[model samples]
Target: MLHKFQQFYPDLERLINFIAISDEYVAKAPSQERFLEVIIRLEREVFGTAKMRGPRVASLRVGEPKNLRDCYDTYKAQKRETVEQVTLELETTVRTLVTDVS
Candidate 1:
């Protein structure tokens, strides 16, 4: 799959190679910032300059919190009620009895 991608986007060969090796050493997916960095670099390479004058195809901030704490808090609040509901279901399941021995 990656070989075919490299063949198609020949200009990204070096970036793809770097990412493959980095993945081996990092053992984790790249962060959003890293993804944006790659996109910006590719845009600059293809356009011959870092064009920041018009609307962009990609952006670093897409309405997401600047830090993990804010994002976590937002999601935690949204999921709190769901978590309570799941806990009640689990407790009920645990207390139920199965009479059929077969």
Candidate 2:
């Protein structure tokens, strides 16, 4: 799964490493609640949000405004921005994880 992801998104190595290390921590957590708490905190610290919540843009309606018809394009642009931001944050988060692990 990871190899496939890397093949498609070569710049995501750091984010993937963060997820891998986080998975290990989550597996070793004492309870599901504890794991959730840790993950939520880590996400808040790294991404500045408790959870990455919501679609990049809200759903469009059948009779949406003319400008709103470009919802798909808006979503794509927002998704790209979010990906860039997450990649930047994950680079620092992964470095922190590596230091802690060492």
Candidate 3:
């Protein structure tokens, strides 16, 4: 998965690698809550308020596992949408440029 993303989305691949390595390190936390906290902090740093952190902050007052999962799902959905929108805009811009040149 990381390899496939490397060519077109190096930044995303790097973020995935960082998250995987971070999870491995945080896996040794003394408590599950501690592990979750560390994971959330790492995610917040990577994804920030524009993506995942906003929903996490608004909906995750309590650290329930279900809420965490929900927030993650929301983050994934929003990220996917944002990527698609950017790709579409880039394609449109390129097409317009090509048409103008022709």
Candidate 4:
């Protein structure tokens, strides 16, 4: 469990980027749905279960170029306001599609 937890954030981020890009390119909704289905299945294998929220993508530069871990640590160090805004935006978007049965 601990080992999986360590890798979860990056894995999660990848899933977010995949979903975000796929949606933005609506001309290929089939391609996006196909990829998302595959990723969802794979994630269940690796991490048991995940709940989709909004999508998040960032070009973050973590300190200590040699240390990828430092990059995530820097992500954690970012200001609270920036983080919350991004989170809320994603939630709103995701929820709209998720609840839109029309």
Best by TM-score: 4
Quantify all predictions' global Cα lDDT against the true fold: 0.52, 0.57, 0.56, 0.58
Q: What would the per-residue lDDT of candidate 2 be over residues 1-102, giving only the tens digit for each residue?
A: 888866865346445645555555666657756655666666655765576554434232232123434455655779777566655666766676666656
Candidate 4 has its poorest 10 consecutive residues by lDDT at 58-67
Question: What CA RMSD would candidate 1 show?
Answer: 18.2
Q: How does each model score on TM-score?
A: 0.25, 0.24, 0.26, 0.28
What lDDT would candidate 3 get against the real structure? Answer: 0.56
Winner on TM-score between 1 and 4 is: 4
1-102 per-residue lDDT for model 4 (tens digits): 999898898778767655654444545555655665655655665676655757734232322223335346555777575557556766776666556633
How well is each residue in 1-102 modelled by candidate 3, as lDDT tens digits?
A: 877756767567556655665545655656755655665656655776223333232222222122334346555779777567656766776676666656
Q: What lDDT score is found at residue 61 in candidate 2?
A: 25
Candidate 1 residue lDDT tens string, 1-102: 888876877557555644544433433566655655555556665765455545445322222223435446555777776556655765554444222211
Q: Model 3, poorest ten-residue lDDT window?
A: 57-66
TM-score attained by model 3: 0.26
Best-first order by TM-score: 4, 3, 1, 2
Give candidates' CA RMSD values in order. 18.2, 16.5, 16.8, 14.7
